[model samples]
Target: MARKAAIIGGGVIGGGWAARFLLNGWDVAVFDPDPEAPRKVGEVIANARQALPALSDVPMPAEGKLSFVSTITEAVEGSEYIQESVSERLDLKHRVFAQIQQVAPGVLIGSSTSGFKPSELQEKAPEPGMIFVAHPFNPVYLLPLAEVVPSPKNPPEAIERAKEILREIGMFPLHVRKEIDAHIADRFLEAVWREALWLVKDGIATTEEIDEAIRMGFGLRWGQMGLFETYRVAGGEAGMKHFMAQFGPCLTWPWTKLMDVPEFNDELVDLIAGQSDAQSGHHSIRELERIRDSNLIGFLRALKERNWGAGKVLREHDERKAAAFFGATDSAPKAAPLEMAHMQVLPGWIDYNGHMTESRYYFANSETIDAFLRLIGAGMDYVAAGHSYYSAETHIRHLGEAKLGDRLTGTIQIISADEKRFRSFVRIMKGEDCVATIEQLCLHVDMAAGKSSPASAEVWAKLKAVADAHANLPLPEGAGRAVGQRK
Candidate 1:
């Protein structure tokens, strides 16, 4: 059974959490006080739906349904996990926690409070085990890390379970050992933020300059490797000890005011705002976010292929996502056999006669069969390497008209095969009806010399293996016989 997740707040972070869970095939129920929550969340999901798939080469899981509820209790009624992304006020969190505890007794509850400790949050809740801290960075769908800080009273098993669930949603869950105010990553962020304020106060660097310094310099390296790891690599053969020893002296220097705080006066605020305006004179926030999302996708995808530390996490997350989608036993069976891809009649594919174009159906069926061939490892690369199967002849029988948005599928069956030629039976199905079938005879060809030739011994073995395995399956009955018939 697919587990359900409930998201409270429905703001940016909450919406992001919803996207992550939905993309991973977990049905999500969301609650927010705002009447506009659904519209706002729909917008976030619209962008995420397009962006998240581009991050991975693997096909994205079937999208899970997103439901909006008016009351928190309704949302958390049967939820396995409740993620609270309400306002970051202690009292607000306390109130929300109290409410959620009333509905979900044993479910794992996570507060997306960047600064509050679990101990403080548990003060208002009935049971500490039900609540913990799950601080995620902005754009939670793209950024992989989630800092999970469990309260001392929370069960160890709950934290581990949360880790597993987060992994399934394509997040790297870092379990913070001790619960401190602001947790782990936020502390570092606070320090940098203070320095940025000081720099702006002293007119040393504008907001954009600081951002540029990080993005153009160390931020690029930080995604695949952390600060310390990058520095350790730079230390050469001596590793961490040598690198720390070399930089240890700099800590004592007066170059950085490690302990200083910045005053947030009106003058400073205006100055920062003025500088931000100057920097972003060209593009809107939405435009900048799009650029950021594209860059993140490319960088993370490259890192994923390397199978490094972070990349390994991504690979595991992808596997979990795949399992969640295809492994859901309660899902409706595939409308057609799991044999080939199909495109229903859409507005673009139809002609003035309200029937699929003759050339278009052929194009569609050919592509469908190509997808099946690719699934069996007979795709582009296989064809490019001096050997490929080609359709010597195709006899198509169109039985019915397919209208726009009609659900369609194609199934392929191997009828016979040998070293030089192979035959296939294909059926194009609309709903439960088989609309068309094609009898195709394919010849193995040598692309290099552009001539008919025998398939490689290995290729012949694989084809025969697939043919034998699927031999018992009934071929489409109306499939016409080939012109040149063999006894």
Candidate 2:
């Protein structure tokens, strides 16, 4: 059954909540009094459509229905979850919760409040035990960290349910142990924000300079290793104890003015805004967002190879996706050749001619092989078991041009299979037209030994089954053709 969620506000955070739910196959009913709510949410969804899929190769659930309702009552009537993202005002939140409780009190309700603690928020709720704070970072669809804070009044089951739901949508839910304003991540963020403001106020560093300092040095380290872990690495042979002993004294030095906040007067605001403009005025907001998303995808993909931090999260999600694909009963049609890969040309893969680049054809072939590997019960778990298939050689023949935005499909036919060697041919097409073809030879090996080896009994049986199924098909036209000039 398709679950439904109600979003009480449709600003940035609310819109993000909508995208997260909708993309995960939850019907979303959004209620916001603002006249431009639909347009705002639509824009956020557009950005999400471009960014989220780039994070993983998984085929996400088909997007659920999105409806903009005029009344909060209409939105919450049949909702399984209700997320409140209105302005950060206690009065307004109290009123909204009162209305929600009047209609749907038992639904799992969460408040996207960065500043308010769950205890404070619950005090105003009609059903305090059911609501908690579910704060998330900006561009919520891309970033997976969600802080789930439950107050003393809230039930433990609510916290567990929230964690389960967040994980289902690929979020890392950090359960704040106690009620505290700003939560965990934001506390660190606020400290940095305070110091940056002081730096600007004292004429020590411009906005761009401060940003460069973070991005060029500690920022990259923090992204993968985090603060204490990075410090532990810096400790060399000793570890965290040594690091704290060496640098703990520096914490008391007159280096930062975190105890006091700079007044946000007009002059200071103008100065900061002007410096920001001088730094990034050339690019539009949308252009800047695209740049940020692209960089995040690239960096996360690199980290994924090492299976570190956020990369580990991405890898685990991919494994889950592969598991679901292999376990599905209603698979591809039992035809002569199974459709192995179905994807659109991503914007980043285009060449000068606005078509998919030549190298991407081989990459697509590799992906096709991966899809087949998952189907044959040789997926991440198989590789983790120290056995995997490695490509020995590939021959690709381009038949036609594949333009950007073209939907491509790869159909596979197993040419032959043995104890250690498996060969397959894949035909890549754009809808009805054949665009390219690839012939690949792969060897099954004990990855730990790093040498060719016979496949395990189970894998061999699966491969033999596929080979038998494909044996009836006639040889393809270009199966053994050479690329050299013919006499």
Candidate 3:
């Protein structure tokens, strides 16, 4: 059954939380008095629908239902979890909690409060243990961190449940050691934000210049190797201990107004706002969001390649989902093309011709074949053991074009196979239409000896079964065509 989550507000943060839940296959009920809430939340979900799938190696779960409810009771009733993101007013949050408890008293309630601690939020609350903090970053659907803060009143079982739920939606739940104002990540961000303000206020830098410094320098390092680790690398021959000792004196330096505050006034606001407007005013908010999402996708994918930092979370999520989606059973393949891969044409997949680049079409087929190989017990472990399949020849035929945001499927039909080699036909489809086809021949090899070799009995048993199943099917049209063959 699809789980249900209640979102008490539908502003940006709330909308983001709604998208995260909905995309992760949780039905969501959002309660926000703003008349424009649906349209606003819809836009965030649209961005999510475009961006999140590109990060997944396996097919994403079917999106769950979303509804804008009239009241907190309607939103919370029957919900397995509730994420309160109402305005940052304690009284307002307390009232929302009161109403929520009247219906579903024990459901897990996570607050998307960036500043407030769990203790303050739990005050005067019945079942305060369930009402802890789940602070997520902006673009919650993409960035995975959710700082989970639990009060002493919150039991260990409930806190563990909260962390597990966050993981199911592909979030990294950093359990706060103790409930404190602003949790962990935001505390660092607040410091940076304050310093940025002081920089602009004192004419040290404009908003654009400060942003440039971060995105162009340490921000890149921090993307994968966060603060201490990045500094550890800067330690060069020595490690973090040596580096810390060397730079410890800089902590007392007056280089930053870390302890001081710039007067929160119109002048500072205007200076920052006016400079920000000049910096990125050309793009609309939606444009900026799309830009940010695309850039993040690239960076995160790089991290995923290294299986480091946030990428490890993404990879682990993919492995779990793939195993569940493609059940390890069914070793005997059916007499048809096995649908092995699901992918979307992300913004990064486009070319100047405004269609999915030719390379991605080929990539789709490779992904499909790779999945099929995994099915036959000849995956990474086989490769690690110095025995693997190597593509010997490939022929790609493009029938139609795929553009950005198009959902694509890749399926493989095993044409023939023996102990050492196999011939396969793969289709790259957009909806019901075959946008392209790939014909490839592969040979099993003993990598250590650098020679083609017969597949092991166990692997061959699985591979031959699938190949024999497809043997009776007619030859795919144009399967053996030459490079310049006619239609």
Q: Count clashing residue pairs per candidate.
A: 0, 0, 0
Name the candidate that leads on lDDT: 3
What does the lDDT read for residue 455 in candidate 1? 77
Ranked by lDDT, top first: 3, 2, 1
TM-score of each: 0.76, 0.84, 0.89
Q: Cα lDDT for residue 22, model 3?
A: 95
| Ranking of models by TM-score | 3, 2, 1
Runs in model 1 deviating more than 4 A are 323-411, 420-462, 465-487
lDDT of 1 by residue, 43-141 (tens): 788768657766653446556889999898999998989999998899988888888888788889888999999989899578888788999987888
lDDT of 2 by residue, 219-318 (tens): 9999999998999999889998998999999999998888999998998899899999999999997788778888988898888888888888788877
Residue 122 lDDT (model 2): 75
Q: Any idea what lDDT model 3 has?
A: 0.90
Model 2 per-residue lDDT at 407: 66
Tens-digit lDDT string for candidate 3 (362-434): 8888888888899999999999989999999999999999986677888888888999999999999999999
What's the true lDDT of residue 259 in model 1? 88
Residue 118, model 3, lDDT: 90
lDDT of model 2, residue 88: 97
